[model samples]
Target chain A: MWYVKNALTRKNLMALTGLFLSFFLIIHLFGNLQLLLPEAEAKLQYNWYSDLLADNILIKIIAMVLYLCIILHTLDAIYLTVKSKKAKGSGYVKDRRGRASKWYSRNMMFLGSIVFLFLVIHFKDFWYQFKFGELPLDANGNKDLYTLVIKAFDQLWYVIVYIIAIIALGYHLLHGVFSAHRTLGLYHPLYSKIVKYLGMAYTIIMTIGYIIIPIFIYLNR
Target chain B: MKIHLKIWRQKDSQSKGEFKDYTLDDVHQELSFLEMLDTLNLKLVKKGEYPVEFDHDCREGICGQCGMMINGIAHGPLKNTTTCQLHMRSFKDGDTIYIEPFKAAAFPVVRDLKVNRSSLDHIITSGGYVSVDTGQAPEANSIPIAHEEAEAAFDAAACIGCGACVASCKNASAALFTSAKITQLELLPQGQTETSKRVISMVKQMEEEGFGHCTNTEACQVECPEDISVLNIARMNYEYNKAKILNK
Candidate 1:
C-alpha cells in the first residue's frame, strides 16, 4: 500500500524495473551477437546457446523476473502517464516550452510506447515461435531459433521494423538510464556526472549493437 | 516601440478563459515587463475598460508573486529571470507576446493572469520547517555548520516558489519546489530532529495536492528563477528513500 500510495515509491518501482530491463539489454545483445558468425558455425552455436538458456534453472528464474519487470514497468508508466495528463491543466497558445528541455526527454512515454509495441511483435516472431510453435531442429538438435531469426531479418520490411524499434529503444534509454539513477537518489555531483556519460555511452553501444544484427543478417542472406 | 499582446483573460476559475488582443505604441524598451503591463493597464483605465489583472508585489524578483507565461515560457524567454525582472528590451519592436497564467490543475486561475497558488503553501504547511521551541533566540554560535553545508543549504533556500518549475514541467510536477524546500532544511543540523517525519509528511501532502510524479525532464531547473539544481530533487529522493527504509 505504501508503495502504491507514495509517488516516490511508484517512481522507485519504475526506476528499479527500468534499470533491470536495461541490464538485460546487454545480455540479450551479447547472446544475439552469435548471429554474426559464419552461417555454418552460427546455426550450431546459436542453437546450443538457446538450448542452454532454455534448460538452465537460473536463466529460467531470471527470465521470469524479466517478464515481471516488463509488465510492472509498462503498468507504472500507464499509471504515471494518466496522472500527468490530469495534472497538466491546460494547453498553452503559441507554446515554446520545448526550448527548455530535450525533445526525447519530454517524450519518453511516446518513445516507450513504440518500443513496447515492437516488443509485442518481437516476442511473437521469436520468443513465441521458439517456445510453443513447432520448429525444425538445427544440426545440434536444438530448436533452430538462429534460422528463425535469420529468416525474419532476411525480409526488408521486417528489418526496417526492427531498425525503427531499436532506434526508439535507443532514445528511450538515452533518457531512461540517467533518469533512473537520479530517481534512485544518486545525488553526488561527480558520480551523477559519471553515470550520465556512462548512460549515454551504454545507450549508443546497445542501439548500434542491436541494429547491426538485423542489417548484417539481411545483407548476408 | 510598438508591441502586440495576446493576454489570457478569465472572469473567474469557473469561467472559460480566452486570449484578448491589444496593441501598445510608444512603449519604452527599458521598462520592466510588469511596468509595461502597468502602462497598458493605465491606458485601458482611461478608456473605461477593465484593465488586465495580474499578480505582483515588491516589483522585485524575490517575492515570487509575479509569474505568468510570456510567449509560452514561465516568466518569458529569459532563463533564470522572473517576470518582474524581465525588461522590454528582450523583445523586438512589434513583437507579439502571448501572456497566460501558469496552468496546472492545482493552480486554478482566480482571474486573468492570477492563479490560486495556495496549493504550494499547503505543501509547506505539511512540514517544510523544523520543530523549534518558542522561548528565545538560540545563541548564534551554538551550532557550527560546515561552510559547504551552509552554502548548499542557502542554494536550496534560494527557491522563490514562483511556480515556474511546475509551469514549465510537462507533467506539472512540483518535485523541484518541494524538494528544494525539503533539502534546505534537511541539510542543516537543526532540521535533523524531524527529518524522517518531515519528508514523509511533505511528500504525502504533495501527492494529495494532485501534482504529477516527477519524470526528471530537468525542465524545472532550466526555468527556475534561482537556478535551483535538479540535484536537490535527487537529494529529496535520497532522503525520502532513507526515511521510508529506516522507518524511523
Candidate 2:
C-alpha cells in the first residue's frame, strides 16, 4: 500500500494523448485533402494556402501548442511504458498462460513507433517542402508545392511506404482511442462497448483515408 | 506439465526465509495453478512433511485471498486472471518455477506463501463505506440509479481485495484496490450524500497506510484475476481532485 500507483492513471494518460492526436489528425486530414484535387486546382497556386497559414499569428500559436502536445504525449507514454514493465517484473515466472489483452493493445508501443517514423517522413516531405523548399514556378507561375506532392506520391516505393505506415497508424489508433476514453473517466458500462467499436471504426476510416491518397495519386498518374 | 519451483520458506513472522525446491509429477494440464499447488500439498502431507500454508477461500478467483509470486510473476504470467484461474496447461513439461508470498513493509509474511493483508482491511475500515443506517431495505427502483452507473459500480466492486494489485505494483501501491472500494460506495444514492467525505477520508486513510502515488503503470490490471477495469482509478482522481479543490 505504500508505493505502487494503480493501473487507472496509465489508461487516462493514453486516453488524453489519443484524443489530442485524433484532433490533430482531423486538421492534418483537411490539409492533405488538397493534394487529392486535380493538378490545376492543387497546383503551385495552392502554395498560397501554406503561406497564409504560416503568416497567421493565431495559427502559429496553435501550431506551437500542437507541437507541445505531441512532445508531452510521447514523453508520458515512455514513462508509462517503463513503469508498466517494472510492475510486470513481479510476475517474471508466471506459468506462461492466458494473455487476455488484445494484441494491438500489447504492441501499442511498437505500432506507435512506426507512426512516429511516418510522421517524420511526412514532415520532411510536406512540412519541410512547404516552408523551406526551393520551388520552381508552375504553369500559373505560383510556387509548385502541388507538383512536388504529386511527384513524390507518383513513386511506387513511396506509395507503398505510405500505405504501410497508414496501416500501422490504424492499428495504433484502433486500440488507443477507446482505451484513452476509458482512462479519462468514461467508465460507463452501458456505452463502453459502443465507444470501443466506434473507436475501431474511427481508426479504420483514418487509416484508409490516408492510405487511399498515395494510391489514388499513383494510379491516376 | 512439470515445473521447477523456487519457493521461499519461512517458519514464522520473525524468521527469515530461503528458497525450497519442489518437483511435481503428472501435473494435469487443465488444473488451475492453485490446484497444482494443492496437488503438491497432498504429496507433502502423504510424505509426513509440513505442508505449505497459503491463504485461500472462494477459489473461484473473486475472493482475492490467494496470491503468490509464481515464477516471479504476481499471479503467474497471465493477463487479467487470478492465480486460481490460471491453468497449468499454460506451462510445458520440465519447467522450473519460483513461488513466494507478497513482500512489503506493511504485509508481513505469515507463513509459507501467505502474507498478512490486514493493512488493506485497515484502509477499508478507516472509511471505505458510507454511514447509512443498516435497518431496512430502501425501494431499489425509486433511487433512480441508471443501469450504466450500477453496472460500472459493480465492476469496481468485483475487486476481492486480493492485494494482487499491490503485489504486482513496483511500488506496492494499493491505488487500484482503494479506488475500487471508493468508487463502489460513491456510486449509489445512499453513497452520494457523503461522496466527498467518503473519498477524502478513504484516500487520507490510504495515504496514511503508506500507499504510493499512481504512476499509471497497468501491471495490476494485467495480473488481476477479476479483470477489474483500471478506469475506476480515473474516477477516484476525478473525485479526489474535485474534493481537494472545492474543499468539500
Candidate 3:
C-alpha cells in the first residue's frame, strides 16, 4: 500500500514521534526539578529518583521507547529533507524567506540538529556516567548522580553549552508544538488558536525550566 | 504610471531562462495585471522581439490558468486576488516588478512565466471523482445535504488549480490544492462510495509527483487567490488517516 510510501505517512510519523518526545520532555523536566532543592535534599532526592528510574523495569521499557523515538525522528527528518530538496529541484535564485514563515519554522532542521548534538553530549555526560561509569554512593546508598550533574554544570563551558542547547530546544518547540497538531489534523480555527497559544506557553515554560536548572546550578556553585 | 519590469524569458521547457528588463511609461492604473502585460507584449512585438510567454485562459480567475510570482508573492501583493483581478493601482509610479515562473520540481518551466502544472492534473486523475453510470443527470435535491455541509464542500470546490498555493509554499508543497479536491468530493453524498479510495490514491499521486511535504507554514492559504483554508489540509490528513485504517 502507498500508505507506507506516501509523504503524508512520513509526516504523520514525524508528528507522532515528535509529540511523543515532547511528552517525554515534560517528564524529564519534572524529575530534573529535584536538582533545584536545598543542597542536602537535592542530593538525596535526585539520586534516589535516578536510582528509581534506573532500576524500574517499566521505566526501562519507556526509556527504550524514548530512544527508538529519537532515532526514528532523526532519520525521518533526514529523509524528508532529502526528498524536499529534490522536490525543490532548483533552489530559489532570490529568496525572500521572512515574508512567508517564522524564522524558526523555516530553520527547524538546523535547530533540531543543534538539539540532537546537545542530546548526544548530554546523554554521554550524564546518562552514560550514571549507568556505566564509576560513581560514589550517597549516605542512603543511592548512586551519586546528583553530584555528577552538579560537577558537570560547574564548568563554565558546560553550562554555556547547556544554555545554548536549551535555547535551541526552545525554538524547536516553538514550531513543533503547534505543528504536530496541524500534522495530525487539528483543523478548527478557534481550537487551532487555543492550541497555538498553549503551545507557546508550554515551550516557554519548559525551556525556562530546563534553562534555569543549569544556570541555577552554575551560579549556586 | 511608469513601471520597470524584470520578466523571466525562456525559449522553451529545456532552455535556460533569465530576467529581461523593460520600462513601461504609458501605463494607466485602471488596467488589470494581465492587461498591463498585454500592453508590454504588444510593445515587444513592434520591435521584432518575441513577447514574453505566460498562461491564461479565462481572465476572470475561475479558470485557474493564469499565475506567476509577482515580486516574490504568488498572484501579486493583493490578498485572495487572482492575477487578472489585481489592478495596476497596487503599484506606484516607477515601480520595479519582478515576475518569475512558479518554482517547483513538478512544475518545470515551459517557457518564460508559464510552467507545466500537469502534475496537479495527474493527482486529480489518480482519484478526484465519483464513479456513476451516465444514464441521466441526477435531480439536484435527490440527496439532501445540510446547508453548512454543502457550503463547506462548495468552499473547497472553489479551488481553481492555479498552482499559486504551490508557488507560495516554501516547500513547494501542493497539500492545499490536493486537499481542496479531496474535501470537495469527500463531503458530498454521491462521493461517499469512492471517498476512501480517492484520498489514498490522490495522496499517493501527490507524493509521487515530487511535491514536498507540507509543514503548515500557512503561506499557501494566505497567498491562495480563492482564500482556500489551510483547514482543508487538516481535513485531507484526517481523510488519509481514515482511509488507511478503515479501508483496509
Candidate 4:
C-alpha cells in the first residue's frame, strides 16, 4: 500500500521532501525580496505584486501546491525523526556531536521545527491578513498590505522572533542545501568546493536579507 | 611501558560476559593495539589463566577481525585505519584501555570481541554473488568498462565487512556494509543479468535481518577503515529506486 511507504520508509521520504522544499524556499525567498525596496517604491510595487499573485488563477493554484509541499516536508521530517530514534534505540550513543557532523546537520529537525512554528505564526500575521483581514486603504484607496507589514514589524518582539526564525531557517537551509546536493549526486570533486561555499554564502545572504526588513521597520518606527 | 587492560570475557554464545582486567609489563609502545592484546594473552597463559579471547587474523589489517573498541570509539579514534594497523604510539604511556566487543542486534557477541559477523555473511550470501558460471577467466580489457566505473567498483569491492560501519553507526545500520557488496556486483558486466533481482533481495534481506536504515551520518565513512564513501550509499539508493520503479 502507499501508506506502507509513508509509514515504513522514512529516509527516502526525507530526502525527497527535503530536496523539494529546498527549492520552494529559494522561490519564496526570491519573491519576498521584492519588499526590500524603499517604502514608497516597495509599498506600491510589492502590494501590486502581491495583489497580482493573489488574483491570478494560475498563481493561486501554484500557491496551493506550495502549501502541499510544506505540509509534506513537515510530515516527512517528523516521520524520519521518529524512525531514526527508534532505530538507534533509547540508549546513550555518546554524543557523536563534535567531529563528524555540523551542529546544524545533527540538529536539523529541531531547527526545522522552529522554522515550522515560525511559518505558522508568519502566515497568520501576514499571509492570511494580507489575503483575508480587512486592511486600511492606501493613498490609492487599495488594501494596504505593505503598510500592514511595516506597521506589524514595528513591534520589538515581532522583529526579534522574525530574526530568530530566519536564523533557524538559515541554519536549516545551510545543512539541507549542501547535504541534498551530496545526496542527489553532486559529485564533481573540484566543483564540490565551489558548491559548498556557494551553499554557505546563500544561507548567510538569505538570512541577513530576511532579517534586515523587520529590523529596518522597527528602527524606522 | 606498563598498562592495565580490562577486556570483555565471554566463554561462548551461551555464557554471560564481564570485564576482566590484567596488567601487562615491559610492553613496547611501538606494538600495534592487537599485538599489545596478544602480549597480555600470552602473559595470562603463563600465569595459568585463560588467554583473553579476541579475534585477529592477517595482523597486517586487511582482515576485519581485529576490531575492538579501544576506548569508546569504534576501531579507536584514528580515521580510516583498522585496529591492527593502529599502533600503540597513538596512546600515551600508562594508559588504561577499556576494550569491548562490537555491539548490535544482528551481530550478537559469540565470545569476547568476536561476534557472529555471519549476519554480514548472510546479507552477502543473499545477493552478494554474481551469477557467472564456471568459465575461463576473462582477459584484461575484454569488457571495456569506463575507467571511472571500474575504479568506483574497485572502491566498493574494497569493503571487508569489518563491521566498523555498523559499530560506528548510531543505529548500527549496515547500509554501507551491504551497499559496498551490492555496488561491487552491480558495477560489473557479469552481474548485469541479475542486477535488478540482486538489489531487491539484498535490501529485503538487510531489512529482514533487523539492521537499521542509514541516516547518511558519514560516521561510518569516518570509521570505515577502508574510507568507503557515503557516495556508495547514494548509489545504492539510486539503484534500488530504479529497480523498484522499472520492475514494479
Q: Largest TM-score belongs to which candidate?
A: 1
Fnat of each prediction?
Answer: 0.79, 0.13, 0.61, 0.16
Per-prediction tally of clashes: 0, 27, 0, 0
Work out the TM-score per prediction. 0.98, 0.72, 0.96, 0.85
Candidate 1 C-alpha error for residue B58, in Å = 1.2
Give the alpha carbon lDDT tens digit for every residue of A1-221 in model 3. 22355678888989999999999999999999999999999999999999999999999999999998999899888888887888886655555534856888878899999999999998899889988999999999999989889999999999999999999999999999898898888888799889999999999999999999999999996
Model 3 misses residue B242 by how many Å?
1.3
The alpha-carbon deviation from the true structure for residue B123 of candidate 1, after best TM-score superposition, in angstroms, is 0.7
Pick the lDDT winner: 1
Residue-level lDDT for A55 in candidate 1:
96
Q: Write candidate 3's Cα lDDT for B1-248 as tens digits.
A: 99999998888878888888999998999999999999999999999999988999899888999998888888888889889889999999999999888899999998898899999999999999889998989898889999998999999999999998888777889999999999999889999789889988998999889999998888888888899989999888988888898878
**Which pairs, if any, clash in model 3?**
none
| Consecutive 10-residue window with the lowest summed lDDT within model 2 chain B | B208-217
Which digits, one per residue and each the tens of the lDDT, describe model 2 over residues B1-248?
Answer: 66777778888889878788999878889888888888888999999998888888888877788888776667777666678888888888998878888765557788989888898999898778768678898776777879888997898888888887777665566878988998888887778878778777777776666555454456678877777767777677678657756983
Separate DockQ for every predicted complex: 0.84, 0.10, 0.67, 0.22
Docking level of model 1: high
Candidate 3: where is the Cα deviation over 4 Å?
A1-4
Docking class of 4: incorrect
Specify the highest-DockQ model's number: 1
TM-score of chain A of 3: 0.97
| lDDT (Cα, tens digit) per residue for candidate 2, span A48-103 | 66666778999998888777766767766676666545433333333322243456
Across residues B1-248, which tens digit of lDDT does each residue of candidate 1 receive?
A: 99999999999999999989999998899999999999999999999999899999978789999999998899998989999999999999989999999999989999999999999999999999888889989997989999999999999999999999999999989999999999999899999789889988998998899888899889999999999999999989999999989994
Global lDDT for candidate 2? Answer: 0.74
Q: What is the TM-score of chain B in candidate 4?
A: 0.94
